[model samples]
Target: MTSFSAAQRSRVTMLDVAERAGVSKASVSRFIGDDRALLSDAIALRIEQAIDALGYRPNQMARGLKRGRTRLIGMLVADIRNPYSIAVMHGVETACRQHGYNLVVCNTDRDDEQERQHLAALRAYNIEGLIVNTLGHHLEQLLELQREMPLVLVDRKVDALHSDLVGLDNPLAVRMALEHLEQQGYRDILLVSEVADGTSSRVERLHSFQSQVSLRKDLRGAIQETGPDLHTRLQAFLAQDGAGPKALFCANGIAALACTKALRELGCRLFEDIGLIALDDLDWYPLVGSGITALAQPTQAIGTSAFDCLLKRLRGDTSPTRSLDFAPQLLIRGSTQPL
Candidate 1:
C-alpha cells in the first residue's frame, strides 16, 4: 500500500482532477466555471467524473477575487441594539442568501469614531457593495468607497453623496401617527425622539411633526429628546394642562421603550393617564398598557430594497439615483383609544 501525508490526503486540487481526467488545466478551468459547453462532450464527462472521484471543490473566494468580484455585501449599522436595525438586517441577509451572495455587517453603536473605523475596515475587506444605516460622518471615506462600488443608504441620507436611498416616507408616517392620535380624541401631542444627531430620518420626522402640528389649529404639540432628563420631561408633559387629552408619539421603537420607561417611573397610568403611539411596531407593544398603537414601517421591505438597489448597481446599472420611500401602516391598539 502507498502512504500519503495527512495534508496530501485531505487536500484535493483542480490540477489533480485535471491529471486524472487526462485533460489540460485550461480545460478543467473552463469546466469548473460553467463553460463546459465549449469542450467536447467526452472531455466534459471525464472532467465531471474526475471531479466527483477526487471530491474536488473550488475556493469561491479565491475564484471571485481573481475575477474582481467578491459577491459580498457590507452593511454598516449605527446601533445594532436597536430593534429596527435588527429587523432591517434580517431582510437584507435573506435577500443576499436568495441571490447567492453573502453579507458582512458592522455595528458602529452610534459613535462617530467607530463609524470611521468600521468604514475603513469594510473597505479593506474589498466588499463589492455597501448598505449604510448610519449618520454619515466620514464623508471622505464614504465618498471614496462609493466611487469604488455600489453604495445604498438606508433610513438616513448623507449630503454630497448621491446614492440610492431606502427608507420610510417620514412626512407621511408622521402625518399618519398624528392623524390617528387626533381621531382617537387626543389633542395634546408630544413627539419624543432620540436626539437627531444629524440623522436624516430623525430630523425629517421632527420637521414633519412641527409642520403638521402647525396646520392643525386644534392640536398642541411639543418635542422632547431621550436622555437623563426624559423622565422629568414626561412628568411635566403629563402634568401640564393641554389642548384636551395628551399622547406621546415615539419616533421609533427605541424612543418608544425610553418614553414608556419614563412614563412608568413617573407612576403614570397607561392610556388612562396618557396615550401612546410609536413608529416601528415591536413585539412587546401589545403586552404594555392597552397595546401601544403603532405606525408600522415595512422594515423588511426597506431592507430587501436596499440590497436590490446594490445588486442593480453591481450589475452595471447606470440609471439615475433613486429614492424609495415606503408608506407606514397604522395599527390601532388600546393605547390610542379615546380617553
Candidate 2:
C-alpha cells in the first residue's frame, strides 16, 4: 500500500476534479471559472458533482489576483456620529449587497488629514469605486482620486470635482422654514450657523432667507449670524431687551439643540419669548417642551439616490454628472406657534 504525504492529501486541485469526473483538467477549469461560454450542460453537471464529492473550495485570493477586480467599494463619511450620515450609509450598504459587492466604511471625523489617509488605505485595497460624504475641504485630493476611480459625492460636494451629488435642496429647505414662520406672524427671524466660513447648505439657506425677507419691508433688517459659541452668545443676546432677533431659524439639528439648551437655561417660554424653527427634523424634536417645528429633509431618499447614482457609474453608464436634490417637508409643531 502507498501512503500519500500530508501536503498532498490536504491539497485539492482542478486535476483531482477532472480525474474524479473522468474529464480533462481544462474542461473542469472552464466549468468552475466564470466564463460560461466554454462550458456545456453535461460537463458543467459533472464538474459540479466532482467539486461536491471532493469538497473543493476555490481560493478567493488567487481568483482576485488573477482577475484584478475585487468587487469591493470604499465609503468615506465625514462623521459617523451624525444621523444623516448613518442613513446615507444604510442606502449604500443595501445597494452594495444587492449587486454582489461589499462595502468598506471609513469615518474621517471631518479632518483633512484623516480623509487623505483613508483614501490611501482604500486605494491599497484596490476598491472598485468610492462613495464620498465629504468635508468639502479636500478638493484637490478628491479631484485627483476621481480621475483614477469612479466616485459619487453625497450630502456635501467638493467645488472642483465634477461628480454625481445627492442632497437635500438647502435653499428650499430654509425657504420652507421661513415661509412657515412668516405665516405664523414671526417676522424678526435669525439664522444661526456653527461655522463662520459657511458651507454650501448654510450659505444657500442664509441667501434664501434674505431674498424672501427682502420682499417684505416689515421683516427685520436681516437674519443674524451667531458665532461658534452659539449657546452662550444666544443667551447674552436674549438677555438684552428687544436686542436679538425675535424668531430663530437654525441651520441644522446641531444648532437647533444648542439653541434649545440656551432657551431652557434662560427660562424662556416657547412662542411667547421667541419663536423657533429648524432644518432637519431631529429624533428629539417631538420630546422637547413644545415640539420643535422643522423642515425635514428626506433622509431615505437622499441615501437611495446616492446609491443609485453610484450603481449607474459602476455599470459604465457615463452620462452627464447629475445632481439629485430632494425637497424638504415642513413639520408644524408647537415651537413655531403660540400656546
Give candidate 2 misplaced runs (Cα > 4 Å). Answer: 1-62, 196-198, 221-228, 240-245
Model 1 pairs whose backbones collide: none
Q: After superposition, how far is residue 131 of candidate 1 from its true place, in Å?
A: 1.4
Q: How far is candidate 1 from the true structure (C-alpha RMSD, Å)?
A: 3.0
The stretch of ten residues in a row with the least summed lDDT in candidate 2 is 1-10
Find the candidate with the highest lDDT and give its number.
1
| Highest-scoring model, TM-score | 1
> Which digits, one per residue and each the tens of the lDDT, describe model 2 over residues 1-339?
335554655597878989998899888767767775788788788888887777776665566757987888889998898777887798788878888888899999988899889988988887878888866576776677777778888877667778898898877786677667777877677788656353565666777777877876656624455555666766665665552347888888877887888778778886578888888888899898678888888887787677778878878888999999899888899888842
In model 1, the Cα lDDT at residue 93 comes to 99
Q: After superposition, how far is residue 113 of candidate 1 from its true place, in Å?
A: 3.0
TM-score of each: 0.90, 0.80
TM-score of 2: 0.80
